[model samples]
Structures are given as structure tokens and as C-alpha cells.
Target: MKTTLSTTFGLLMLSAAVMASATEMPVVKPLRGTVESVSNNTLTFTNRAGAQQTIGLTDKTGFVEVSKADIDSIKADSFVGSAAIPQADGSLKALEVTVFESSLKGSGEGHYGWQNADGSTGTMTNGTVGKLSKANGRTLTVNYKGGEKQLVVPDDVPIAYVEPGKKDALIKGAKIVAFPAGDGKNARGVAIGKDGFQPPM
Candidate 1:
């Protein structure tokens, strides 16, 4: 009876060890990061630990750590790795990036002091005008005086104008006059004329 009990305990210990090993394995996902360095198909990255580790991009490997879907849509000949920081969730957050090519460039106009979806403020440049629109969450949906269009603006993009009008007054049930920044451009801005009409603000 003692020998039989010993064998059963040994089996249970082996099963527990296998289960622990399985649970400790890291899950692989398509991740993009700025390439610290690259050799062949292997790229190194500064992980959340501040230590650099190399990863092999195989058929099973997903893309690296890009937040913007537009940036992720970009195709590249070579992989660029960047450092990743940890998020509240266990997912890796990108700190820096190395891109192989320039992504699509576009601009739009909207409220100069408009609040962004990410709680940032929109800054308009002086004497420069682009079509204005309300950002639909993170998506750039411009609502110009004329019409609406989907625009993609870069993080480094600069706005050209910051009007001094009240936010509520600008959109109050008033007629909006929109004209392109140039004779041939689609750029436009909304303005309430002083024709006996009071804007909401």
C-alpha cells in the first residue's frame, strides 16, 4: 500500500509540473516595434523590461507594435523595430518607431481649439486654412462648410488657422460660408456672417 501510494503521488507531481510549464509559455501575437537592430529575419527590440531581445519573424509571427491602424496599413520591405512600454493591460505599447517608408500624407481643417478624441487640443496655424471637421473618435472626419470628407492627419501635422469665434456660435443654426484655401483646392472653413443672425455661443 505504501509503494502504490508513492507511485500515485509521483504521477500527480508530474502532471502538475506539465500544467505549470504550459501556463508559463508566452502567447505570440502579431506585434510591431521599432527595430533596435536586424540581422536576416531576426529583429531586436527594447522590451518593456529595458532589455533588448531578438525575435524571429516567421510565418507564425504577427506584425509588430503599431497603434495607428493607418500606420499599420503601410507596407514595408524591411521590418523596423521600436521600444515597447507596458500598458495597463498586458499588451505592449510602442515608444518609438523606425519606418521604412513614408506613410500617406493628408490634411484637414476643423475647429482650431477643437478637442481631440484622445483628450488633446487641436492647434491651428496662422494664415493657413484647411477644411474643418469633427473628429469621429480617433477617425478624422472633417465637417467643412461645404461638405464632409475622411481625412488622415499625421501626428506632426500643423493647422494653419485658429479662429477667435466661440465654439457654440460657430455651429449655431447659421449659414456657413466655405471656400477653398486656394482657387483649386478643396480646403474650406465655416464662418457665420453678421447678417442679423446670432450664433448659439
Candidate 2:
């Protein structure tokens, strides 16, 4: 009887251990905020309400920093932001970020038209060219033909318009259009049109 009781107790203990091990682990959500401070292996960000939080840097994280080359890429008043993604080797990596500034406001020397998805066309002799400077923050100004206009581009606008001189090197005259990639997200890319502009660099 004693041997049987001991065996039963051992089985119960093993069952309890298995149940405990089956418990779910906690989930970690993505963190979002403005960078407050940056260090070699960590970054501190302030939330919308001004609360500060720090996150440890990891291989899967991304980073962006200001550089002289980046400054010359956009208009004078444009603001820039960067992002870092983590790499598989446990190091921080840089993610591409857009810079926003005012749009190029001016009259089109040649006629330009906006073709709606429904196959309707609208002409803008005084067409404005604007780009979303950063991920989704503000606008950057570009000179079209002659005037100044504000273009409210959405966030996630891909590298649509390259600098004039660099156009040949990037996309050989790609026109900007909304390329919606499901889930309510829209991306800006060169469209298939008469001009046959190239894709962004």
C-alpha cells in the first residue's frame, strides 16, 4: 500500500510541473515616441504626453541619424527623421526614413493632368509638386515651374521625386501616384503613364 501511494504522489507532482510549464508568457508591444536621448546601446523617448521611456537596443532595432548628405537632399526648411531596425546578428541597423518640407509651388511650363482611378482627367496648369518629408510628419518644398505650394503628402510616401540633378541617376522622370498596399496603407511610387517615369532610387 505504501509503495502504491508513493507512486501516485510522484505522478501527481509530474502532472503539476507540466501544467506550470504550459502557462503562457507575456507579450511585448511595439514602442512609439520621440527620441529624447540616444546612447551607444540604448535610446530614451518621450511619449505624446511628455512621459519618458527607455528601451534597450537590440539587433532587431533600427536607427537613423542626421548627416550633411541628408541635409542637402531636401529643401532648405525640410526636417528629417531616421529609424533603426534590429539585425539578426544582435546589432542595430538603419531603416530608410523620408524628409518632409514645403512643396514646389509654380505654374507648369507644360500641361500636366491628374488622372483619377475612374478614368477621369483634371488639368492643373498651376500644378504643385510636394513630398512628404519624413514618415508622416510634414511637407518639403520642391520647385515645379515657378510658384510655392504646400503639398500634404501622407506618411509612408516612398522616395517619389528625387532631386532635379539626381533624377537621371534615380528614376529618370518618374511621376508620383498613390500605390495603395492594402490594410489602409498607401505608398507613393512612380506610375505607369505616358512619360514612363522610372521607379525611385
Candidate 3:
């Protein structure tokens, strides 16, 4: 009886540990697309590859709006996040850039791997803007914790700003970048487009 009780306790402890670890894992952003329809708790959208996807939204699913911005919206010391493709000259050519609101400073602060909508790999760098110049196009230095990067923004790249949004923003034709739960059928949060601007990241 003593050995059996010890085994049961050990099993319970292991199960609890596994559950805790699973709960702490980071949410994945695997769904990026434009919303086609939205029901009470479920939404259908078209992915970048032109496939339709339907996902459920929990009550806790959050939303934010990305509004159009221009290069003039960025300034020295502005906090920003840019997803860029690495150029042969060791600089980054931006695919899209976002000037984050003051309240969102330090959100996802890092230089890390990113996967583009076309399935190509890229890098996302979130940092403070430094030494911005537009002599040729738009070039700026991004300073993060450990290092800095110089990014070249082309004329056609999307530039935007993020702000709090309402659920009504998830209407038809809305483009979004949504973070999904582990199951991949439910959304944890989404950054949706507003005022004709798409959420590029």
C-alpha cells in the first residue's frame, strides 16, 4: 500500500509539472489574412496563400488597430518595429515598419526570426529610431538592447502605427495578423487594419 501511494503522488506531481509548462509556452502567430466574415464567436478569413481559414475567438481574444502612417510619423527616439529582408550589403531592406504608440513601448522588444507571408524567412527588430535620413530613400538606425541595425525603407513599403481597437474593427476586408492558441483553431489576439491600412506584421 505504501509503494502504491508513493507512485500515485509521483504521477500527480509529474502531470502538474507538464500542465504548468504547457501553459507557459508562447502563443504562436500562424494565421495572417483578411477577414471575410465574422459570426458570434467564429471568423473566416483568407490566408496569404489564398486559402480560406475559419477560427474561433474566445472571450479573451484581444484586438488592436494598425493605422496608416508615413515616414514623417517616425522621429528620432521613436519606438518602432520593422520586419525586413536582409540585403547583400549587410543592411536590412524593410518590408514593413510600424511606429508603436507610446503606451506600447517595449512590446516584443528584440531582434528575432520572422516568417514572411510568402513563407520566406526574415528578421523583426523592435527598437528606438536613431539617425534617420531620407537622402536616397528612408534610412534609419534601430538601437535595441545589445546592438543596432540600419534599415533602408523603400518607397512602397507599408508604414503604420498601432493603437487600441474595438471588435467592430474586425469587419469584412480587414487584414490582420493574429496569434493563435496551441490548438491553431482559436485566436488569442489580433492586430487588425484600420483606415485602409493593413497590418503588415
Candidate 4:
């Protein structure tokens, strides 16, 4: 993917800013930070840990914005993942559910901390949709790499999808994550989650 982080967003400049840790990582590692500045095809951002860095982009660079979606939009047999809170009766209630792109199947396929908005530690799992039950609440049977979990889908829970966007959307203070190709400093951004919503793992 080609990407060009432009210089200019609020006070962030892509061309005239900082860069750090040119170290190596796996094929595609997560690179997230706050927009400090941006220049055409390049941008400097400050990570959650307060480190500022610059990343390069090109025309093929992917730009997506994570926007809310409805639970009813989920389809059967679709590969999906959810951050859920365990219910009292051994059921899991989702805090966020994401219908993943096919290419992302098997990625982050296990359970992990959900960090629910309500403060309880929720569990996140990626799986295939089995069935949907509207009986008690909307319940979904989702299967993953090795196991399945019955999840309750609440209409109000926040679910998101990546949508196309322009560089203007990459404004200062916007939370963004750049998907690094092979070089640690230059890569294409797959998506940018708005308002600091956690990017789907």
C-alpha cells in the first residue's frame, strides 16, 4: 500500500517533525499514536507512551475510519470478533463486535482483555458466525480458530467498521494507527479509529 502522510493537521506536520526507534518487527506490527503533525505523504505522531515518530505513506496507502455499525447487520458464516463481558449464566455479552475482513481471519483469534466501557474486564474473541437467536436478547453463536462462544449482542453496544477517508480526516488529536509494511518508519495505514476507539485487533 502506498501512503503519503501530508504535512498539516491542527499543529501536526508530517514533514517537519520527529522520528524514533527504526527497529524491526513482525511483518505487520501495530503502530498507533496521536497526530502531532502531518505533511503530504508523511506524518509525525506521538504514541500512547508519549514517544513522537514519523511515518511515510504513498498513493496506495489505505485510509480507513472506524465508524459505528449495527448488530443486525451481522451475517451468518461471517468471520467476526468481539470484546465481550461474561454473564452470570456462563454467557458472554458483547461490548464491541467487529465483522472482520476475510484477509484478517485468524488474526487475534484468542480471548483477551476487553476493557469494557463499564469497567469490568471483558473477553475478546475472533470467530465465525454460527447462528443468531433473538429469544432472550440477540444471541449469536460465534466460532473461532479452536473453539466457539455464545455471545449476546446488545443493540447499544459499540461495533465498528473501517470506512474510506481522505487525509483531511487525519487531523491533529485524532487517534491513529499506521500499519507498517516492513520498514518500521514507512508504511501504509489500514485504518484510523475515531475518538480513540480501540482499533480492532
Candidate 5:
């Protein structure tokens, strides 16, 4: 009995070490928050409510920072989300767009009708790209979240993409979207942004 207990405890300790070393990805939830530290290839950050998290990164882990782009850069089948205002003709005119990183392909895939800052009707949607149009600036359809919407992506729509950046970008004061790991309790970070260019988390 003594030997068996010892073995069991040893196994538990080993499992804990592995979990602390590198986190896993499950369904990809947002791990948005501020940074705490970066060591052993693991990023320690805090959530909006001030809860600290430690997530390790492997070679396959994605570390991308936001960069500027235009509406034309959006492509079909790309995972994206946007905040837009409703037009008179019943089309959403994009105000801001963010192209999600590959690790967050299906994260929070849905359509949300939100209120605009100016009291206008705003729609927030995230899903896979479907089609694009060149008439009237550009019209786009994103098919996911069990729904679809035709959006007028203006040529001047502010767009951002997660381009590859240095690992050090995950430093303190950095904002990141950490995907939930297999455990569903702790999170694993994949993409991050710095200098106030935050992802739509």
C-alpha cells in the first residue's frame, strides 16, 4: 500500500509539471488580458478581472501581432469578425474589421446585434468568409455562427491582421487572446498584440 501511494503521488506531480510547462488548446476561447511575465517559453498574463494565467508556448504555437490592412486584403474562407452599422438598404457597413489568427479559426463564431456608440444599430459578427463584391465599395458575406450577413466593407474600413512577431512581444503590458486549453479551466495563448492594437477579444 505504501509503495502504491508513492507511485500515485509521483505521477500526480509529473502531470502537474507538464501542465505548468506547456498548455493545450481545446475549443479556442479568448485569453485576453495584461501580461505578468514570460519565462520558460511560457507566458503569464492576467485576465480583465485581474486573474493571472500562465500558458506555455510550443514551436507550433502561433505568436502574431496586429498590423494594418485594407478591406481588399480580406479573403474568402478567412476567419474574421467585424463591427458595422446598418445601412438604409439593410446592409451592414463595416466600421472595423479584424482577421483572426489561424489558432482562433472558430472561436466565438456567431452574430451579435450590438448598439453603436452614436445610438445607431451596430452588428458584431464573426465567422468564415463566404463571398465578396466590388459594387458599392465591397459587399461581403460571412457564413458561420448558424447565420449569415451581407456586409458592405468600405474601402476605408479599418482592418487589422495578426502578423508574425517576435516572441518577446508577449511582454508585460501586452494584450493577448489566449485560447482555452483542453482542461477548459486554464487558457493557452496563441496570438498577441502590442502597443494598444488589441484584437477584438
Candidate 6:
């Protein structure tokens, strides 16, 4: 009787552990893609790998539009995200820069690794713009939580602005960076292109 009871307890504990893990939510990575079509609250798109994928969108799904911007759009106190490559002098040079809307001030508020459009790896820094200088090129001092980075935006670097968008903006050929839900097949939010502008970040 003692042996049987011990075995039963162990089985129950194992079953409970399995159940707990099964209910745990998944960590989802963002998906970058171009919209091919949208219908019935579903989005069909081609990802960076050129594979067709679909994600379901509900009424609660959020959308933000990215529009063409230039160096003139960035100013002191503006919140921005820049994808940059490090230079020999230790300062970073901007590959692309995004002027984030007020609501997105603290989004991705740190310096970390980012993948560029050309399949090269760089760093992404999202923070508040501090000072602006144009001595050589456009240099922006960006301040984040623990540190700050000085980024140089050259003449040819692409720039874009992010703003609130509606479902109508999700038309064909729009580029997007989608945040997936825990299931990985439903969209929580997306930053989609406005007009022909692709989301640089």
C-alpha cells in the first residue's frame, strides 16, 4: 500500500508540472513582411524569406503608419529609433532613422542588436533626442535609460515617421513589422507603411 501511494503521488506531481508548462505563454518575435492581400480579418504576406504567411487580425489589433521623413523632421526632444553601424571612432553612423510618435516614446527603449535590410547586423537605439549638431553631418545625441549614443545621420540615410493608422492602410505592397500574439499566428499590432514608404526600423 505504501509503494502504491508513493507512485501515485509522483504521477500526480508529474501531470501537474506538464499541465503548468502547457498553459505557459510563448515568447514571440516580430515578423517583417510585405502585404500581399487582406481579407476576412486575415493578412496574407510574404516574409523576408519570400515565403507566404498569414496572420489573423481581430478588431483589437493595432496599426501604425510609417511615412516618409527627412532630417528636417527630427529635432531636439524628439523620440527616435536609429539603426546604425559602429564607426572606427566609436560613434555610430545611421543606416536608417525613425522619428517615433509621442505614444511610442519608450518603445524598445534601449541599445541592442538589429538586423538591417541588407542582411547585415547593426545596433538599434531608441531614445529621446538630446542635442543636434550639423558640423560634419547631422549628429544626434540620443539618451536612453542607462547610457546615450551619438549617431551621425548622413545625407543619404533613409528616415521615416511613425503615426497612428487605420485598417485601410494595410493595402497591397505595404511593408510591415508585425508583433505577434502568444499564439504566433495572430497579430497584436503592426507598423505598416504609408504610401510607398517601407518601415526602415
Local error of candidate 2 at residue 15 (angstroms): 80
In the range 1-201, model 2's lDDT, one tens digit per residue, is 333332322221122223323334111112333444546544455533557655454332212111123323544434322222333553222222234222221211212232222333322222233453554543444333444344433334333322211112112222222221122121111122124442221
- Count: clashes, candidate 6: 0
**Candidate 6 C-alpha error for residue 2, in Å:** 62
**In lDDT terms, which candidate is top?**
6
> What is the per-residue lDDT of model 6 for residues 5-59, given as tens digits with 9 covering 90 to 100?
3232222112222332343421124578999999999999999899999998886
Q: What is the C-alpha lDDT of each candidate?
A: 0.26, 0.29, 0.72, 0.60, 0.62, 0.74
Ranking by TM-score: 3, 6, 4, 5, 2, 1
Off by over 4 Å in 3: 1-30
Q: Is candidate 3 or candidate 5 better by TM-score?
A: 3
For model 5, residues 135-188, the per-residue Cα lDDT tens digits are 756778988756788887777767887544556787788777665444634433
On a 0 to 1 TM-score scale, where does candidate 2 land against the true structure?
0.23
How do all models score by TM-score? 0.20, 0.23, 0.77, 0.56, 0.52, 0.76
Worst 10 residues of 1 by lDDT: 100-109
Of the candidates shown, which would achieve the greatest TM-score relative to the real structure? 3
Q: List the residue pairs that clash in candidate 5.
A: 31-178
Stronger candidate by lDDT (1 vs 3): 3
Where model 6 places Cα greater than 4 Å from the true spot, the runs are 1-30, 58-60, 181-183
Instruction: State the displacement of the C-alpha of residue 36, model 5, in Å, after optimal TM-score superposition.
Output: 9.7
Q: What local lDDT score does residue 195 receive in model 5, on the 0 to 100 scale? A: 82
Per-residue alpha-carbon lDDT of candidate 4 for residues 1-201, written as tens digits (9 for 90 to 100):
111222111001111111222323111235667787779778788876788888887665656666666676677877667767688998788777776554444434544443333444556666678887776546888886567888998777767764445677777887785766444556645456677665543
Q: Encode model 3's per-residue lDDT on 122-172: one tens digit a residue.
A: 777778898999766689999988889999988788889976566788899
Those runs of model 2 whose alpha carbons end farther than 4 Å from true positions after fitting are 1-73, 77-111, 116-135, 142-146, 161-201
